[model samples]
Target: MSAQTPEAPTVTTEERPAKERKVPRVVILGGGYVGFYTALRLRRRLGKREAAIVVVDPRSYMTYQPFLPEAAAGALEPRHVVVSHRRELKGVDTLTGRVTEIRHADRTVTITPTEGQPYDITYDHLVVALGSVARTLPIPGLAEQAIGFKQVEEAIALRNDVLNKLDTAASTWDPEARRRLLTFTFVGGGFAGIEAIAEVEDMARAAVGYYDSISPEDLRFVMIEGSARILPELGDEMGGYALEQLRKRNIEVHLSTFLSSCVDGHVVTSTGVEFDSATIVWTAGVKANPVLNSSDLPLDKMGRLNALPTLQVAHEDGTVVEGAWTAGDCAAVPDLANPGSYCSPSAQHAVRQARHLGDNLGRFLRSAEPTSYEHKHVGTVASLGLGKGVAQVYGIKLRGWPAWFMHRTYHMAQMPTFNRKVRIVLDWTLALLFRRELVALGRLHDPRADFRDASAAPRPKGAQKPADKAPQSEKVATPAP
Candidate 1:
C-alpha cells in the first residue's frame, strides 16, 4: 500500500452516502372548489421537489357547481361541468378516499379509500377544505324522496327525472296521477334554488312542446322559501327584480314559507299549502361537513373550522394553529374587509381565499411570515332561466337580458380551465343550433338493470341449478278441448 492511511478513506461509488430527500408533505382533505384550486395554485407556487402535495376526495373529479343549473337544464353537458382531478392535477397526488379522522397531535390523517384497506398518512401541513353538505330538516320523507342539486350526477339525474315525469304525465290517464307527475316543488330561495328551479322550468316548458297532451300550464313549478325574500345575493332591489321576473313566467313564488312535510311526495308547507308533487328538489341550504368533529381542530358554533384571516386554523383563543390551514365553506375565516365578521361561504370568496392560502403557504414554507387575506365584495349576478337575470356588479344594478349576459360572462371567465370554458361555449352554440336533448336517459338511475338481466340469464346445460318448488296444481281443461 502506497499509503496505509489512504486505505481508511477509500470509498466505492455504491458505498457512498446518498443525499436525503426532504420534501414537506401537504395533505388537503377535499377535492371541492377550494381544495382543487388551492392545490392548483400550490403546485404552481412550489414544484414537486419543493413539496409533496396530496389531495383526498371521495370523487375523482371536481364539479364546477355554478354550472350545475345549466347542466340540469341541458344547456351544458354534465361532463363539461366536471374536472377530472387525476388528469388535471399532474404534479400533485390525488387519492379517491375520505379522511375519516385527523389526529392533529401526530399530524396524521386516517384515509378510507374507495377500495382496499384504510391507511394513515402523515403530513407536515394539513388543509381542511372538506366543504359543506346539503343541510336537511327533520321533516318526514325528505331524505327518502327528495333529490338534491349539488353534484353533476344529481344535475343529470334531476334532468332525466323531470323529463321522465313529463313523459309519465303525458301518458297517465288519472287526473291525480297527472297532477302529481306535473308538479315540481323547489325548496330554498338562494341562488341554487332559484337558478335550478328557473333552468329546469325552462327545460320542462320546452319539453312540454313535444307532448301533444301536455302544455307549459300543466307543468307547475313552485318555489318555497323560509325567508321573506329570494336571491338576497342580488340585494333587495335586484332580488325583488328576480322575484318579479320568475313570477312573470308563472312560476309560483311562496315566500316566508317552510316545508312541513314531504311524506310520499305530498309536500306540506307551513303556509297551509299541501299538494302531491312527484318531484321535490331540495336546495335548502348547506351545513359544514359534520366530519369536523373527527379532528381536534377548533370549530365555531355552526361547526365550521375556526380560521384566522390568514386562512390558518386557529385556536379557541384565536391563536393560529401551526401547520394547519383551512378555507371554503368549512373554514370560518375572519373577514378583513368587514371588521368583526367572517367571510361568507361563497364561491368567489372560496377562490380568492384559495389564492391567498396558496401564497401564504408558499411564503410559510420558505421561512417567511404569512400575510392576511382581504378582498372587497364585488357583487352578485343571478340567472332566472334563459334570457332573464338580475345582477349588482360593482354597485351597478342590471336586470333582464343584460344581467343574464353578465351572469354568463362572469361565470365563463371563472369556470376553471380553458378546456371547460371552450366546451361550455360550444355546448351553448350547439344548443342554439339544434334541439335540446329532451329524451330522458332514465335507465341511468338503475344502471344495474343490464347486470341484473345478465345474472337472470339462463345458464348452460350443466351449469344450471334447479330451483326448489312446491308441487304444481292441475290445470283446468279448455272449453274447446
Candidate 2:
C-alpha cells in the first residue's frame, strides 16, 4: 500500500518558460545600400555570437545604384557594380526572401522566399531599409513596355535592348520602323533619369559609328520632364547649365511636359507631342517600398517611414518607437544640417545613416543610449558618359571632363569594399588601354534560343504538336554599335 506509483511527472500548461535565447536577434529587411552598409558595420561592431544579424532581400547582391547608369552605358561591368551579400557580409545570415509583412506588435516578420513555403521570423529588433520602387503613373502600356533603371538586371537588359534596337534600325529599310528604332524617350529629369539618358545617348551615338546606314544624327534622344526645370537639385543656375549642356548634345529636353501614354511604341506627352519609339526608359521617380504599409509603422504623408533624427522609428506623437530603426529611401529621417527639413533620399545620406544606425544599434544592445544621425552632404556628382559629367561640390560648380573625373574619383572612393574599388578602377584602366566593349550580350537573356530552334525545326513526316510549349525569348531588335 505504501508503494504508490511514482507520481507522473507533472507538466504545467506554462511548463518550462520558453528558454530566452542568449543572443539578441536583429533582423534587417532589404539588401540595398542601407541594409548592406548597416549589416556590414554591425558585423564588425559586434562579436559573432553576441547578436544574430539576419538580412532578408529578394536580391542576393546590392546594386550600387549610382553606378547603374554606367553599367547600362557599358562603362562599368554589371557584376562589379553589385556587391555580393554573401561575399561582403561575413558571419551574418543572409536570406534570399522578400519580407511580405512585418508585425511589430508581435515582433515577427513574414518572409516569402523565391521558392518554398512562407514562414514567420521573430526578432528582438527590426531595421526597415526596404528602399523604393520606380514610381509610375497609370498610363496605358507603361507597365507592359517601359523599363526601369533601378536594378542591375534592368540595366543589363536595357543595354541589350538598346543595342538590339540599333541593329534593327541598321538593317531595316522602312522609314517608320527606322524612326521607331532610332527614337529613344526617357521620362523624368532627376539625377537618375538625366544620367541614364545622357549616358545611354552617348553610348548609342558611339554605337552608330559601326552601323552602315544609321548615323548619330539619325537617332533621337528625347527627355520629357514634368517640371519647368531639369536637375532641380543643382539650383536654378546649375540646372539651367545642365539643360544647355543636354541641348548641345542634341538631346531634346521638353520642360513642363509629362508622358501621357506609351501605347505600344506610340508615345504621347502632355506637351502635345507624340512620337513612336522602340525604347522608353522611365526613371520618373521612386516612392518608399509599399511593404511599409504592411506593418503598423507610422508613415508620413508621402508614405515614407516617420523617423527621428536619431534614425529610430517615430510615433505620430513625436516619440521614438523602441526596438525599431530605419534609414535610406524608406525613412524620412530629420536632417540636422537643414532646419525644418528631412534628409534627401540619396546615397550620401543612406551610407552615413547606415554607419550611424549600426553604431546606435550596438549601443542599444548594450543598454546604452543611442546617438543621433547627423551629416552635412559634401556634394552631388553625376556622370553623363565616358568623359562627361556635372558636379556641385562644396558650392563649387564643375562640368565637362573635370566634373566627370571627380564623379569617378568620389564614387570610386565610396564604392563599398576595397576589392570592389580596385576592380572598378582596373576596369577603367583597361578601358583606357583598349576600346570600349560595344558587343551587346543580348543573347544572354535568351541562352536557350538555339536549343529551342533546333527542337522546333521542321521534322520528318508527321511531327506531332509538342506537349509543353517551348519558352519563347523576348524579341530584341538589334541595331549595330
Candidate 3:
C-alpha cells in the first residue's frame, strides 16, 4: 500500500461507481431503422459531448431492407444495401450485444454479447428500436424447407438456391427432375413476394437463352396467397393492373390459396393440388421482435411497445417511463393523425418516425420539450419485372417504365446514403446499357470436388449414375427473362 504498483493501480467506487456517472447516457437498442437513424440524428444534434450516446445491436451495420429483392435479383450489389453502424455513428459508442432484458425498475439493461460473460448496461435514457421479424405461422414443413425474404443473408442464399435449381434442371435429362428444379413457388402475394417472383422469373427467363436445351416455357412460376388480392396498398385499380401484368408473364397467381402441407420439396395446397418445387419463399408478414416481450414495458396485442405520441413509453397509468422512448414498426404509438387506426409497419413510417425520434431525443437531452410524431401516407410504387411495373403514387397511376422509374427514383432518394444511392443508380444505368442477367451462381455454396468425382464415377456399359449430386455453375443453362 505504501508503494503503489505502477503496473496496476486500484480504483475506488469514487472513480467508477456501481451507479451511473454524471455523463447523460442514452442507450438506443437495435441498429435497424429506428436504431441507426436515431443514433445518427442524436449524434448530430447533441454536439460532440453533450450526451453519451451508446448504440447496442446484434449486427454492426443497418441493412436497408427495401433493396433486398433487387439484391436477390442481381439488380443491386449486395454490399451497397447495408449501412455500417460504426462508420455512420461517429461519436456514439457501439456495443455488439443482444439485449436479454430491460429492467426499468433499476434503470438498467442486461445484454448477452456474442462472446464473454453477460454484462449490465446503465442508461439515463433508453430508446427501444428493436425492429420486426418475419411473421411466421405454424405451417408444416415451413420451418425446414421454406426460406424467409426478410434478411440479406436469406436473400443471397435464396438467389444462390434459385440459380442452383436452374443448373440442376439444365444438367439432368430426366423430364421429372427437370420439372422439379424449374418449378418455383412463393407463398404470399404482398409486395415482397410479388416483386421477388417477378424478378426471379424475369431473370430465369432471360438466362434460358444461354442453354440450347432449356426454354423459358420450361420454367414454372406459381404464386399462392391466402388473400384474394395483392398489393393492398395500391387499392383495386392498380392491384388489378399488377395482377394482369403478372398473369401476362404466365405467372400462376392463386388467390385464396395457401400451402396446406409441404413435405420435402412437394407442396400440397388446400385445393388438393400437389407439385414439386425446389424453391419456396415466405414473405407473408412481420411481427415485433420477441425481445420486447422480455422487457417490462407495456406492449400491444402483437407484442409492440405502447409508445406515446411524444415518442415516450407510457404505462397503464399514463405516465411516461421517465427516460424511455420507442418508434418504428415495433412501437404501438398512438396515431394522433387518425382517430383509431394504428401505424402500418412499413419503411415509410419507420423512416419518418426515426427522424422525429432523433429530434425528440435531442429535445429531451437539452431539457427542451419533445415533439409528437405524426406523418401522412405518401404513395406506393412497385416494380414487376424488366421495365414492366405499376404504381399509384399520390393518386397518380403509372405503369411500364414510368412506374419502374418511380420505383427506382423514390427508393433511390431514400436509400440511406449518397454512396449507396450512387451504387444503385450505377447498377440501374449499367442495366440500361446491358440486358438483365439471369445466370445462376449456385456452385458457390460448396467448393468441394469429391461430390463431382463421385458423380463422375465410372459406370457400367449401360447402367446410369443416379442424378443426385449437387449442382454446378458450369452446367449453365440459358436464362428465362
Candidate 4:
C-alpha cells in the first residue's frame, strides 16, 4: 500500500536570460569522410562545452563506398553501407544543404539550401570538406543519359534500372528491341566503373531466373576506357588479372576507347564503334567542386585549395587563412610519403587526415603545437562479383576468393553501425543457405495495367467475373446457304 501525497508548487528560478554559450561553434561543410570524422573526433577531444560542431551537407548519411558493389549484387543490403550522421555523431548539429560560397574574411558562409529559405551561417572555426563532384564531358546527351556512383541512392537506382532492363528484354518479342535492351555500357575502367559493371551484371544474370525467354548468354556488358589499361591505381600485374577476370565473365573490356557521343540511345565510341543500349553508366573521374574556386584561398592548377601539411588553408605567400581549414578531395595537401607528390583523393587518406585535422584544430585552439598530416599509402582491393577479386597490399598480390573474402571482411569492419553490420551478416548467412536467383519485379512500378481495360470494355451490369459475360468457344455461329 502506497500513500498519495499532494504535489507542491514548482519553483521557478529567476530566469537568467538564456546565457549565451561561450564555446565557439565549429561549422563543418559536407558530411563525408573529412567532415564526419572531423566532427566525430572533435567532439570526443574537446568535450561538448569547449566547442559546438555543426555539419552541413545535402545528405545526413556517410556512404561506405567500397561495399556499394556488394549492395548492387545483393551481397549486402543498401541501407547497411550508409551511416546516419544524427544517430552516430553525438553533440553535433547536422544541416542538410549545399554551401554556395564562403566569406572567409568574416568567418561566415552563404549557403543556398535545397529547400526552405536560404540563410547565412556564422562560425568561429570553419572546416571546408565539400569534397568533389562527378567529372563529365561535352559529349552529346550525356547529362540526360548518365549516372554517378558516389552515394547509396545511386547504387540502388542503378540496381533497379538494370533489373528493369532485364525485364523489358525478357517480355519483348522484337529481336532488335530485345538486343538493345540487354546491352549495357559503362565508361571508365577505374574502381567505380569496374565494380559497378560487375555487380549490376551479376544481379541482372540472377534476374534471368523468372524469364523463360531470356538466357544469360543473351546479355552483353561492355567497359570502355580511354587509357591503355584499367585500374591504374592498382598498378600493372593486378590490373592485368582484373582484365582477365572480366573477360572470363564475358564482359567486353574496351581499352583506349572514348565516348564521342551518346545522343538518344545511340552511343558512338572514338574507335569508330557504335551501339544502342538501354543503360550507359559514367564513372570516369571526379573534379574539385567549383564552389571552392569562388573562395579567396590559394588554389592548385586543378582549382583544389592548396592545403598545408597542418590541413589549414594557406596563401601563396605561406600563411594560414584565419579560422579556415580544408580536407578531402577539395584540398591538395603535400604527400610527405612521396616527395614531389600531392595526396591522392581517396577515402583511406581523407578519413585519417580528417581525424588529424580535428585534433590539430583543437590543439591550435588550446594554444598547443599542431602536427603535420602524414600517412603511408595502403594498397588497393577490388571485387569482381561473386567470389572473384584482386588485391595488392605492401607489394604483395592476392587473387581469387582469398582477395574477395579479405575485401568483404575489411569493409564489414568499416561499415558504420552494429545494427547495420548485424543485418548485413544475416543477409550473407542467408545467402549461403539459399540458391542464386535472377528475379526482377518490374511491374511493381505499375501493377494496375492488367485490370485497366476490364471495366472500360462494354460489360453487363454487376459483372462479378470477367469470364462470365465473355463469348463462349465456337461463338455458336450458324451460316445460311
Candidate 5:
C-alpha cells in the first residue's frame, strides 16, 4: 500500500469557535447637555470590556447656554462658556460631524463630517440628543437680515456688531443714519430675548461713553413680544415686575406685538410702529432640530422625540424602544410632577434630565430596572443686566441685585466643570476692578476678507476699484441664524 499521509482534519464551518461578540457600542448624537453628561456617566461606570462609547456632534464643544448673555456682554470670557468634548469626554470616541439620518430599526446612523464623505456608524444603543435650533418665521427679510442667539459665536458677533454700530453712529452727521445705526431691536420677550437685550443694552450704554457724540439716551433698545407678558414662566406678578424694570431702563417693551417686516434695515411691527434698525437680534424661540424629520424614531407634534419618564424613546403604542434614549430640548419627556404636561424646554430641566438619563442608561446596560426622571422645577431666574435681575423660586419673588446674585450663584454651580467656574469667577472679579472690555472685533466675522482681497487679481488701471466698497461701519454683518 502506498504510504498515505494522514488526511488533514476537515473542520466544518460550524465547528469553528463562534467569533467573540463585539462589546456593545453606545452612540450618542449631539454634544449638548444630554449627550455630554450621558457619555461622561457611561465612561465612568462601564469599562472598555463592558461597552464602547461614541459621541457625534457638529460642534466639538458644548455651549453652556445659560451663560451666553454674560458672554455677549463681556461679563464672562467667551471661551469659558463652552466646554470641550475631547477634553471632558475622555476614553470615548468623539466624532465632529452632523448626523444626517438615523435608522433606529437597523441600529445605524449616517454622519456627514465637517469635511469628508458621509459614513455609517452602527450602534447597539442609540441616543438622540440633537438639541434645538432657532425657531424662525417666514417673515420678510428675517432669513437675510436677523442674527440668532443660540451659540457663543453669535454672542460674540453681536457684541462686536453693537460696538461697531455705536462707532458708525457717532461719526455720522446724518440724523436718520445715526438713528438707524443706534437702534437695536430684539424680537421675542422670553428669557433669552429679555436677557440678551438687557445685557447688550447694558454693555452698549457703557460703550457709548467712549464716543463723544453718543449718549445712553441716543441708543434705542426695542423689544417686541407677540404675547401680552414677558417671562411668562415666572408667573403673572413676576412677569409684570420684569416688564416694569425693563421699562425703567428706557427699553421699549411692546407687548402683544409682532415683527411684521425688517427688510433693508426698516422694521415694521404688527402694532403699526415702524423704524429703521441696523441691528436686529432674533431670540424668538427654539424648535427641535429639524434633523429629527429624517429619523425613523417616534416624534411628538412639536417634532421632538417622544420619551417616557425613564427617558427611553417610546412608541406610539406606549412601549419602550429598547436601547434607544433621549433627553434635553429634543425630547418630549412626560413631566410626572406636572400631570398631563411635558417638561418645559429650559436649562433647568435639561441639566436634571441629562443626569437622570445618564443614570437610567447605565442601569439599562447592567440589566437593572430603569428609574423614571422626576424633579420638581425649583424656579426660574433671569438676569436683566449687571447688578440687576428677576427670579421666582418656590413661589417667592425677588428682583434687582439679590436676584442677579442668585442668578450668578445658581448658574455657577451648574456650569459643568471646576475650570469653567473658576474662569467665570475671575472674569467677574476683573470686571468689578476694571471697566468692561468695550473693543469690537467685527473683523473676526470675516477674517479671510482681507486675505481674499489681497489674493484677488489686480484690477486694470482706471477700473475705479469697484466704486470703493461700502465701509465696514455702513455694512451690517448678518450672523448665522
Candidate 6:
C-alpha cells in the first residue's frame, strides 16, 4: 500500500464536485381534507424547482365523510364517496404509510409503511393534518362488539351487517333471537350518531319489504345520547325539531342517557333501560389523532396541536414554530370569528381550514406575510333518512325534503374533483330511477374466509366420514388386548 500510495492522491476542495442543493421538501402528514387540499394547492403554487411535496397517509384516498350516511344507505355507490390521492395530487408524491414520529428539531419524520422497514424523511416544511379518530370510552364490550362510523369501510360494513342481520332474523323461528337481531342500538346523539342511525334505519325499513317475515314494526332503533339534547351543534330549536322527527319515525331517543355497557349484545343504559341488540354502532365522538403526541409540537390539554389563526404551529405565547403548519381536527385552531373560542371539529371547518392553511403555507414558502383564517358559522344540516332531513342555515330553519335536498346539494358542491362530483351525481340520478339495493355482501369483510374453507385439507381418500361412522355405543364393545 505504501508503494502504491502514489503521492497520496492529493485533492483539494476545488477538485471535488460541488454538492448540489436539495430542493426544499414539504412533507404533509395525513391525506384527509387538510392534507389533500394543502398538497394540491402547494403543487399548483410551487414549481418543480421550488419545492418537492410529499403526502403521507395509511389510506390512499380521501374519504368524503359527509356522504358516508348516504353511501351506507346505498343512495350513493361506495366508490363515489372517496377521492384517490394519486389521481388528484398530480405533481405531489404520495406515500401510503403512517408517520410514527416527527423530529421537527431535526426537520425529519419517521414513516412506518404498511410493509417494509421504517424510514426517516427529511423535510424543509411539515404539515400536520392527521385528523381525528373515534373517541371511544372504556365501557364494557365497546372495544369487542361496537363498530365506529368514521371511514367508508365502516359504512359499508355496517350496511352489510345490518342487511345480513335482517336476513338471519327473517329466517329464524326463535322470537327472542329475532327480536335481538332486529334491535339496532346507536350510541351518541351528535350529527354522526343521528345521521347514521337515521340513514341505516331507512335502509333497513325499506329492506324489510323484501322479507315476508319481517315488517317495519319489527325493527327497533334506539339512540343513546349523554347530553341533554341531540344535534347540539344545531340550536335547541333545531335540535328539538330533529328529535321530534326521529320520534315520529318510531326511533327511541334517550336524552341525557349514556351507554353503560354492551356486553355480549346486551345493552344497558344510564337511564335504567336494557335491551339485547345484535348491532351496536358507536358514533360517540372523536379525538385528535394520538400520533401528535409522538412529535415535539405544542399540544393543548385535549391533545390537539396548538395552532395559530394563521394555521402555523405555535406556542402558548403565540410564537410560531418555524416550518410547521397544521389544521383539521388534529389542531386546536382558534376560531377567529368567535373570540376566545376554538373552531369546532366539523367538515365545514375542516374544508375551509385546509384551504386557508394551504394559502398560508404557500405564502410561507414564498417568504410572504401569512394571513389569519376566519369563517363564520354558516349552518348545520342533517339527513334523517332518504327523503327526510333537518337544517339550520344563517338563522333559518328547514326540515323535510327541503333540508334533505340542501344536505345533498351542499355536500355535492363541496366534494372535491369533477370526476367524483359527476360520479356521485350519476349515482343519485340512478338511485332516483330504481329502488335501493338491499343485498348484503357480508363476505366482503372476510373475503378470504370462503377460500380458506375451500382450501382446507380435503378428507383423506377412503377416510370414513363422521356421519358414516358407527355410534360408539352401537359399535361392538371390543375388550382391550
lDDT of 6 by residue, 52-124 (tens): 9999999999999999999999998999999999999998899999889999999999999999999999999
lDDT of 1 by residue, 99-207 (tens): 8998899999999988899999999999888999999989999999899988999999999999999877775556898999889999999999999999999989888
- Per-residue lDDT tens digits for candidate 4, residues 1-481, read 9999989865443332324446788999989888988998888889776788999998989988888877767777788788899998988999988888888888888777778887999999899999998999999988888888888877776777788887667655568888888899999999989988887887777777667778889899999999999999888888999999899989998899999988886889999899888788889999998898777668888989888899998887778887888899999899989978999998778888999999999998778988998999988888888888898877788999988887777767766668778887888888899965445455555679768866576768886765534355434532110
TM-score per model over all chains: 0.90, 0.91, 0.88, 0.87, 0.92, 0.91
Count clashing residue pairs per candidate. Answer: 0, 8, 16, 4, 0, 0
Q: Which candidate do you rate higher for lDDT, 2 or 4? A: 2
Error of 2 at 228 (Å): 0.7
- For each candidate in the order shown, give its overall lDDT on alpha carbons: 0.89, 0.89, 0.85, 0.84, 0.91, 0.91
Give the C-alpha miss distance for residue 46 in model 5, angstroms: 1.3
Error of 4 at 233 (Å): 1.5
The worst-scoring run of ten residues by lDDT in candidate 2 lies at 470-479
Alpha-carbon RMSD to native, per candidate? 7.0, 5.7, 6.1, 9.5, 5.1, 7.4
Runs in model 2 deviating more than 4 A are 1-21, 457-481
Compared with the true structure, what per-residue lDDT tens digits does model 2 show for residues 377-465? 89888877778888899999998899999999988888999999999999899989987788887689889998999888586678765
Model 4: how far residue 72 lies from native, Å: 1.7
Give the runs in model 5 whose Cα sits over 4 Å from its true position. 1-21, 455-481
Which candidate should be chosen as best, given TM-score against the real structure? Answer: 5
Which consecutive 10 residues in model 1 have the weakest lDDT in total? Answer: 472-481
Worst 10 residues of 5 by lDDT: 472-481
